[model samples]
Target: MIVPLRKCLVPEFILGDGATNLANRYIKFFNPKKVLVVTDRGLKKTKLVSNVEKQLKADNISYCIYDNISPNPRDYEVMEGADVYRKEDCNVILAIGGGSPTDAAKGIGIVSTNHHHIKSFEGVDKILAPMPPLVCIPTTAGTSADISQFAIILDTELKTKLAIISKTVVPDTSLIDAETTLTMDKELTAATGIDALVHAIEAYVSTASSVITDMNALEAIKLVKQYLPLTIKSPLNLEYRNKMMLASLLAGIAFSNASLGLVHAMAHALGGLKDAPHGMCNAILLDHVIDFNFESATNKYVDIGNAFGINLDSSNPASSKALLIEALQEFKHICGIQPGLKQIGLKKADFRELAQKAYNDSCIVTNPKDAEIADIEKILEYAW
Candidate 1:
């Protein structure tokens, strides 16, 4: 058999404790005229953003802050941020929050340099020009937008989400400091941690999955399974927190190359339509999508079982699959994740639109099992 060609992409990442402090060094290296520090209002209360500000001030690196970002970043937010970037004469983008801020920063870069509306660059590789230099300090570990080629931007007019899949949107550098994640509440930690798990699982089973991506995905799954609950119990435990950060990084690398599947597709729609949390949406849809995808990717599911520490009986595939599902369910319960989409205000009437949008999502193309609108609707029903 002739193996197809593949490519892997990742950002220049500095990972460890106090890695965020290196922001000034990178800023000086880039030597931009000025910098835009993109973040959400919530993170402003934490010392993390302030610390970065202090460092930038100490280094005399002129910078401005765009703190209007929300959990699910919208099109207007990107446009507004682009205006800020251009008006402030900021040539570099520095993001200092979770997925929202990071994703927003990517959007700001696109519009800043491309001189086009953010929504115009919705689909894959729509961006022709390179974006401004981006430096990411990931506060909560999930979305992986800092390291990935995917940027999810919500369209306020359409009341849905669109994905911008392109290498140009990937950050130039990421400071993965575990210390920045210490201030996250338990709910945020659980949601983002599970989001990392879903990223690994979907990437591992994707049709685009390569040997390298599979390796990263499996390691990410193991780390999340082993450390997520512990981090919740001991939120201040740097060891567990750092491990989860590593898992998120590994999963980001994996999914950014391999792409994701139904979980993300559905989550994107939920986040856009219901104004739900991306990680929470992923957490709710993950198990059901896994179950939907199991038959087509049995061997991969067995691998997942192993990653989750479920001893699988190779002789009985059904038993192995069940064990994996049980393990995931137990983890969900331990993380205090709510049971269904209904809990997040997903109405039955909204199922059709959600299903159609998910079916059209870019991530759905790589799913192990092909999901049509009906199939997606069924999955949403199950999740509901």
Candidate 2:
């Protein structure tokens, strides 16, 4: 049997307490002319950004901060950030936040170097030029934008998210500090933790999944199931925080290599359309997508169930599917993520449009089950 070729891509990452402070050390290796510090306004209010700024100042590294980023980063914002990068003569991009700011940084890096509109680079491997050195400090436990080869930017005119999948946009280094996540409120923590779980599950069942990706995905699933709730209950416990961070890293590497599936595809579509929280959107759609894709990846679903500590009866596929879905719903409920699509401002009228957009998303290509627009609409109906 001829094995199909597969590749895994990951950034050089440092993990642990105070890892964010190492950004300046990595930036110095680039010997940047000026660093473009990309982050959201919300992070500016925290000491996290200030601490990094202090490190840059100590190293005498010239830098400019572009904190005008939204939760769902816009194309205009990327263009604007690119302009800032050029105007400041910045050669290195340092992102210090969750997915939003890191994704914006990737967009800025692409636009600054490729000299094209961000929209043109949508889909897979469209990036022609190498982006500037990017060092990411992810404050959130999920999204894993710090280590991902994918960048999602919302197109303001089209009101849809552009999925830019390319190796060129992957960061040079990631500082994955669990301490940074200590400041997240219970809501953010729950949403992002479940987002990591979704990443692992999707990657595990992705049609493109390789042995390497499966190992990472299954371990991530196990860690998330064990640690996510503990972190939520003991919000400030460093041990739980560290474990969740590790889970996020593992899941990020898995999905970055194997790509995701219907849940991410639908979540991206819903997030782009409603400007909703990406993690929350994933949480809402995960179990429904699992139910839809279960038969297509029955063995993989059973593996995931085992990781979740549910002893699914694999001999009985129907019972196994029901058990997995019920367990996932219970997990989400325990994590305080109970809202459905309808509760999050999605209208039944928008289902077709959302499904069409999701079908067109890059992530759908790796889904275990091939999904049509109508199938996605039905999934939306179930989720609603």
List lDDT for all candidates, in order: 0.91, 0.93
**Counted clashes in each candidate structure:** 0, 0
lDDT of 1: 0.91
Model 2: per-residue Cα lDDT over 1-384, one tens digit each: 676699878889998877887878999999989999999988988898999999999999999999999999999999999999999999999998999999999999999999999999999999999999999999999899999999999998878899999999889999888999998988999999999999999999999998888999999999999999899999999999999999999999999999999999999899989998989999999988988899999999999999899998778999999999999899899899956998899999999999999999999999999999999999999999
Please, what's the RMSD in Å of model 1? 1.2
Model 1, backbone clash pairs (residues 3+ apart or across chains), number = 0
Instruction: For model 2, give the 10-residue run with minimal summed lDDT.
Output: 1-10
Tell me the TM-score of model 1.
0.98
Cα RMSD for candidates in order: 1.2, 1.1
* Highest TM-score scorer: 2
